[model samples]
Target: MGTKRLKKQWLLHAVGGLLMTGLGLSLFGEALIKKWENAPLWDWLLWGTLALLVFNAGVSLVGQAVVFRVKLDGRNEK
Candidate 1:
């Protein structure tokens, strides 16, 4: 890929990761808070968000890998 395309891909990967992480944390926020004791609400929120971000980062990286693999395969077929 060209530098511009590569940068775009990276940006997409980042955006996708952020989306998934935020979604995961938001969906599970309440449950997480209930499971812990003496935990401030903001603390739970922060932890949940971090966990989601980490999860998303991993998933997005995998997604980027798959995308590159597919592109490579297509190029080889030509």
Candidate 2:
């Protein structure tokens, strides 16, 4: 694949990761706040778990983007 294409993919990965992390955090917060309102135990667990998964996925994506960036930089140095 071309360098430009790789850069675009890297950018997409970074942006997607950031958005996923933000959304997950927001959801997690909402789930936590539900405790004060006497929400069901299962509801809390479900939302909290889902949010964590999303957050983890986002972090992984961001990590991949960093790897791509590092490899690209190395190539540029040659």
Model 1 TM: 0.49
The TM-score of predicted model 2 comes to 0.92
Which segments of candidate 2 are over 4 A away from where they belong?
none
Which regions of candidate 1 deviate over 4 angstroms? 2-35
* Candidate with the greatest TM-score versus the true structure: 2
- Model 2 deviation from native, Cα RMSD in Å: 1.0
Span of ten consecutive residues with least summed lDDT in model 1: 26-35
For 1-67, candidate 2 gives per-residue lDDT tens digits of 6789879988999999999999899889988988667899998888899999999999999998998
lDDT of 2 at 58: 94
